[model samples]
Target: MAAVDTTLRRTLIEYGQTTLAVVVLLVGWEVLCNVLSVPKWLLPAPSQIAADTWEIRAVLPMHFGATLAAVVGGFVLAIVTGIPIAVLVVYSPFLRRVIFPFLLTLQSVPKVALAPLLLLWIGYGLHSNMIVAATVAFFPIVINTATGLESVDKELLELTRSLDASTARVFWCVRLPWALPYIFSSLKVAITLAVIGAVVAEFVGSDKGLGYLILTSSGAMKTSVMFGVLLLLSLLGIASFYAVAWAERRLCPWYLPTNTDPPAI
Candidate 1:
């Protein structure tokens, strides 16, 4: 009970700090815009951004849903595709030799640069966005999983082999379990990248999503609308990242990066 209390207190403190920081930033932004007498089109104050966001609340659901769907779908696809590829690479030297180089080359190619090409090949729609998001997200998952799988203690592997454990049994019991933390860490990163990629794809060519809203607002000089869309996108990314982190904490309760254990009192 004491440990749980301590963890809860720490969490509350962290959230309080974050909220305080955000309040300070928002206050500064509002004051700066007011002091400068910036034009509404150039730098609408926070109040203006909030009003604009409210004005578009009716249409926001559909665009937000579309973007969310793309990000989730692409992230799921990356996990399904990347893990198997990682396994093959880890197990088969021939595959590792052939596939690793290709993946490296593909990673070097800016996925945003490929956005237009994706639009050309996949057409202008959520499909292209999903592809782009998966492209941006999968590399991290594959590399991290592979590294975790390969980095297992050599002594443990030798012991398992001495016990005449089957390859499948060894992998299922040892390697897969050992690699989970790395996999989840990569998942956290991939979720954020997935959101960015979906937005980039939308930016490249789309009539929906917050990204599209930002582009149209940019042309019309609707700074308030752009700020609203930017905030929405940031919220989406934060939500996605926290979702992954929640799963990570559930699966790896022993892996606390911030030393959640109670300190000496």
Candidate 2:
């Protein structure tokens, strides 16, 4: 109970600090807009943005749902595809040696540069958007899973080997469990990137989703609506991040107890 209370207090303090910072920033933004006599078309006040969002609440939910579906679909695809590839790479040194450099090269080539080609290949719609999002999100999961698998304690592996554990058994019992934390950490990052990728795809070509709404609102000089879309995007990112974090807490409780108090740094 004492430990739980300590953790709760620390979490509340952090949340309060973040809320204070955001309030300061919003107040400053409003002040600057007023001082410079900035047109609403150029920079809407937070209140205007809020009003715009409230006005479009119904339509906004539909657009938000579309974006969410694409993001979740692509994110799941990346995880499913990446983890298997990671396992194969770990199990086969030959394959890892041959493919690691190519994987790195693929990751380096900007996904935005390939979005047009993807659209050409997949055609416009959810499929193209999902492919782009998955491509952008794949590398992190693969790299993190591979790193986790490779970083297994040598002593632990030797012990299992001495016990004559089969490769499949060793992997299922040891490697996968050990890699959970690293994979979840990567998941937190990948979820945000997934949202970005979905938005980028929509920006490039799409009639639906928040990204398309943003483009439309900007073109019409509906600055408040554009700001509202931006806010929705931010909220999407935050929600996905916390969802992953919550799953991590549920699935990997050992890490929290072992780490004890949060680090000062």
Task: Identify the leading candidate in terms of TM-score.
Answer: 1
Which model scores highest in lDDT? Answer: 1
TM-scores across all candidates? 0.91, 0.89
lDDT of 2 by residue, 1-265 (tens): 9988988888999999999999999999989888888899988888888988789888988899889988998899899989999988988999899989988998999988888888888989987898889989989999999999988999999999999999899898999989999999899889998998899899889989999899999998899999889988999989999999999999989876775557763
Q: Which stretches of candidate 1 lie over 4 Å from their true place?
A: 1-17, 257-259, 262-265
Clashing residue pairs found in predicted model 2: none
Cα lDDT tens digits for candidate 1, 199-236: 99999999898888889889988889899989888999
C-alpha lDDT of all candidate models, in order: 0.92, 0.90
Q: In candidate 2, how many Å is residue 135 off?
A: 0.7
Query: Candidate 2: which stretches are off by over 4 Å?
Result: 1-21, 257-265
| C-alpha-based local distance difference test score of model 2 | 0.90
Given candidate 2, what's the lDDT at residue 55?
Answer: 90
